[model samples]
Target: MMAFANFLFIVFLLPSLEALSNVNPSEYQQELNTQALILQACSNVENLSSCLSNFQGELQKSGPPTAQSIIHAALRATLDEASRAIDTITKFNSLSISYREQVAIEDCKELLDFSVSELAWSLMEMNRIRAGIKNVHYEGNLKAWLSAALSNPDTCLEGFEGTDRHLENFISGSIKQVTQLIGNVLGLYTQLHSLPFKPTRHDHNATTTKSSSDKFPEWMTEGDQGLLKGSSLGMHVDAIVALDGSGHYRTITEAINEAPSYSTRRYIIYVKTGVYRENIDMKRKKSYIMLVGDGIGKTVVTGNRNFMQGWTTFRTATVAVSGKGFIARDMTFRNTAGPLNHQAVALRVDSDQSAFYRCSMEGYQDTLYAHSLRQFYRECEIHGTIDYIFGNGAAVFQECKIYTRVPLPLQKVTITAQGRKSPHQSTGFSIQNSYIFASQPTYLGRPWKQYSRTVFMNTYMSALVQPRGWLEWYGNFALGTLWYGEYRNRGPGALLSGRVKWPGYHIIKDARTAKFFTVAQFIDGMSWLPSTGIKFTVGLGN
Candidate 1:
């Protein structure tokens, strides 16, 4: 009994032994390591010493702390902060303010309410882990929940942008505090998972899937694959939009309107070489529709509707698709609205089992909204300024080129903003064997939602990628909970050493773990992608 008591003393009360003159050497060393790791993680915070002191006390109560315990406690702490924020924001909303301020306050209140739920999600996830479920998706779900929780507060503050309110200073301070705490959570997670900032000894190797003759379905004939791979002019076309009155229809919409509704067979629309300045809406009933264009430069679909024109951020999409099994090849979808006209979306796809091959989506902000469901982009070019490629979708950009346009002075750029609001969503952005070129300093992604998940595998990142690599959405604190990772990437911007010290970003050290984000894992691309004959490199692009 005495020996057991002594063991408990060493494990739980060792931190208090530092003042004792004759502490056990082994126990003291153990305490030192625990404190050192905690302090090291908090170093990125401006109030480092205070953060350390606060965590140290919490650590003492946690017993013999493991990585999981630390994370659990951190989540609880964040929940406390979130609760305080909800209370503060709620009180502010009750106070008298201008009609515009009230609107902003209402938006913030809704965001904060959602944030509280997200934080609760983290706690629920933590509870599941503590219950010893240890499922494969356990950690993934936890990360997602934490990420979403962190993003909620930041988004709440974003609602007040450009508004003149006396509560701005106070609100900002409160949000930053929550942000810093969440950052600490992420930093801690990073430390436990990937040995933070230090390169592991594991070799970065690219893994590929096996190729076989029977890989594709029986319906996908070689002739169909050949037509999709090359130019489709003069081929048997169900309808054509020549823009020169020579084809079946003058506009793409007219061609679509004429096609047999709810047809099981592929309705191919051959768009001739010309810039079509029109908004295209592919309704849900339009399934198995294929848009074959005359090449990216020759065939262009452009629009300029923006929030400044009183368009909702979502409705601003130039070409919005809610169809299933939709395909577009060798086309350019452009939103001509410049950066100043924020929230302009060029292409918004909510289609399931959609494929965009050798295409281009161009704009300044929110260019390609991979809205939802399963989507694939191969050998395509995506150009935008901030969060140009964002949405809550299981989309994979394979062998595509992501171009970041120059932003106005004092403006930062982000390439992807994946919005995976829930852990069970199984949605994210996977850019494999792609190349990212930026004219201005840019980040690989910012969390549009808390559980935002994104991975860059075997991609080439240019010098334009900022040293930080990933940015917090205007001080959003999701580093601990988001799923951001880089695997065996090459080129100047592939340096992980200079990347942000956030906990959510991972430097994948092995093929098994890296494979989790592959085209096969993320979107089950192996099943349908081969049928298109459009090539996709799977596994870890080491």
Candidate 2:
């Protein structure tokens, strides 16, 4: 009996102990590889030790780090950092602070909430990718989420400006640590994509064909088609709004506020030709709201909100759309907030899967804010000075007109500021088959973030474009990570030799690569854009 008991202990308990003590070879190798990758990527980041320490416990618990596992680890660290910010800000909010400081603290809390949500979303996307459920929109969605995660903190810090320097510094330090962790995660995600091995296709059911408008999906109903072409005003929709009190509502907001929340159907609001001097905010609950007006200049929505008024830049949009599936056509949204005021946004679109057709967004500074998600601008005119067309959304401007407002003295002009904060994000400004005309010396874009991306393809540029096609953001060495590219752009401003010799700048030779920036592929416009019935050239040549 004693011998048998000893045998059992040796075979069962001893082996179990051994298993716990020793790492499996495969697991060991995976961990080593992951560490190597992290070290390789974070070599330049001075906070490497702190970054690793933040994620170490999570990474160890995760076991055998695959690309997804590393990404998960990074996200966990970022989320933890965001939580600290939340706690810090919450404590700050409870203090005896000045009115401006209180406001800034409140803003910080909201932004920290956003950061947490975005980090959570980044984790979710990684899980989805791991589970073989590939979303065509996943890349852009993930990037926009992480970028928002990073940008919100910066914005929060900006709010604290002139409020309290010590508080601002404290908040900045906390947020900056989190931002670095996120940035490292972004770099890791990008590394996964750049790996030589082809990623195993887990989503066998997903269609992998190149975007061709010929394969329109079931969502493109005939009624939808009619609305796209300006033929149908969607009269069957909930209401008609007119400035002259000819319809159910006189103001656009009145109609929007009364509409069914999250209604799947199009809530059409037809605005007759007249200048309406009001700020219109299509709230999130008012999904699928469609606004149409008598062609551009005739039917206008205008405002005069500027940064000089102490309003947050995000709050200064003339026509702000946070609703999903929002559509605007044949109208002009203008911020008469001149160049002197700085950072005045004409139209700020935070809507997901939103679209603008034949619309004009006119302002002197910070004109159009493509704030987030997938957005498409077709046959539209965007006029601005400075970083006029800005934000972190995966946006496509097809066959549109990009106009540059005259700049104030010593105020250099840039057309787009693609604020992609993460390398993993597919968000960028893809100006395809568009026309760029400016009165003053202009640049195609400036890097607004570390990994800013802007591409111009088959577009026409006037001679007013500066010889140095793209400029840096002050002295920022963003050229190394910024993705500024041009392809088949014609006219005097299309001089490739005179363009910046930045490491991230590209002169595209492959049509296929250029095609990636097209409306069909870039924004996944082919799937749902056709439903709007707006005629769009979905390809480079079209």
Candidate 3:
């Protein structure tokens, strides 16, 4: 019995001794690796030593840390700075200020509010990974939100063009530091494979359906299926807008106001055959709202607001959707504020998981302001001129027709002005399997932001496309940073011989290399598009 007790002592004590013996070699080496990787991430960041300090406490607390954890800490740091900026903006607004100062401050407040939302979104995505809800698209989504958050301060500074430099100085320094931190985090995220911890991915089954027996996807109810099938019988029409006294609401706004907030199921609003001239809006609370129409041209929602008419570009949408999971089918959204009335927007959609099928957006400039979030457009007609398809949304357009109208002779006809401000952002124009028909001489797009990205794949471009293919936004700006690519495109203007020779422009050599911009890889559309009943190809198809 004495020998057995002594043996147990030796057995337990050895591990402790062994742990102490190798602690310096193994653990210290791991910490060194962690520090090295994080330091590499802090490359190009201002005040590198201060930025490294933010990770010190987080790194010391745990075993080895991951890029994910580092990103979470980075976001926390960014949010704190942004919150302080908000407080400063609010305090400044209450003080005595001129009209220019007031307007600029108000605009800055609104933009900072959006930046806060973007940070919140980034945090949510990070937390989702922690909650074990693994998603391949989480990286893409986080990049988009963080990039937008970083760009907000820059965008706010743009709004203060004529205002005093003092006001811009107030928010610029603090927010600029915050954006630098965000950029550092994004740079770290690119090394996720090198960092520890792989997300245990699970199948995202929320937007996919398996229905062999029905004519529609399983997520669709009997009523919605019937309505989309060209009959109103058995249709669960939540609201209807008609010109005569034959519907639930006379105007589209009335029907939108009636939509219940936070609805899990769809609230179908059927608009009858009429040109209902109204600027429609759907707020954030009104999720899962479906707008069905009699037909594309038959049911029109038109507005004539423009920047020239004293309205901001954001406020000029004929139909602005801010809800999540919004769907619009068989409709035409138009802004009659023609080409001369610059910056007129026909449809402004900033909704997540929004889908537009078989619709038409008609305007000369800013035809479709796909402002943000994940969006899908299939079989739609978008007519515009001069930086029309603009915004920083992670958007995809499949089998659509994009027509360029005549712009002011001096006003260059550029189809897209994608505002992706960061290299890591997943936001860009992925025009795949589409047609670009030009009524005037046009360029494919110009870099709207430093790291702007736009890809045209498996599409046809008309001959009127300018020989240079892409025009520069400004002299020597974004020429090396922007990413513009073309793959397997056909037609008179698809030739690569005359395309921009910028370092960022690529004539993709093969399908495998170009697959990164496909529907499946870019936005993870396969997880959602099946439910929308939209025809989309996952990759370069025969």
Best by TM-score: 3
- On residues 425-472, what C-alpha lDDT tens digit does candidate 1 reach at each position? 567888888899877888999998778899998899999788889989
TM-score (all chains, Cα) for each model: 0.63, 0.80, 0.84
Candidate numbers, best lDDT first, in rank order: 3, 2, 1
**lDDT tens per residue, model 3, 1-542:** 44554343345335435655657777756655655665554444555555555555554443346666666766676676677777877776755255556666766676677777878888888778767785766766676666666666665666555456676777677657766766766666665733554544343322233222334666667766766666667777889889895999999899999889989777889899999999987876788888999888999999998876656576678999978789998999999999888989999877777899889999999899887778988889999998889988888898899998888768989999988887777788898889999979999999989888999988999999887899899898999999999988889989889888999999988766677777676776766666775556666654
> Which ranges in model 3 have alpha carbons more than 4 Å from their true place?
1-23, 33-64, 94-107, 134-137, 161-166, 197-215, 230-232
Taken over the whole model, the C-alpha lDDT of each candidate is 0.72, 0.75, 0.76
Model 2 alpha-carbon miss at residue 264, Å: 4.9
Worst 10 contiguous positions by lDDT, candidate 1: 195-204
The pairs that clash in candidate 3 are: none
TM-score of 1: 0.63
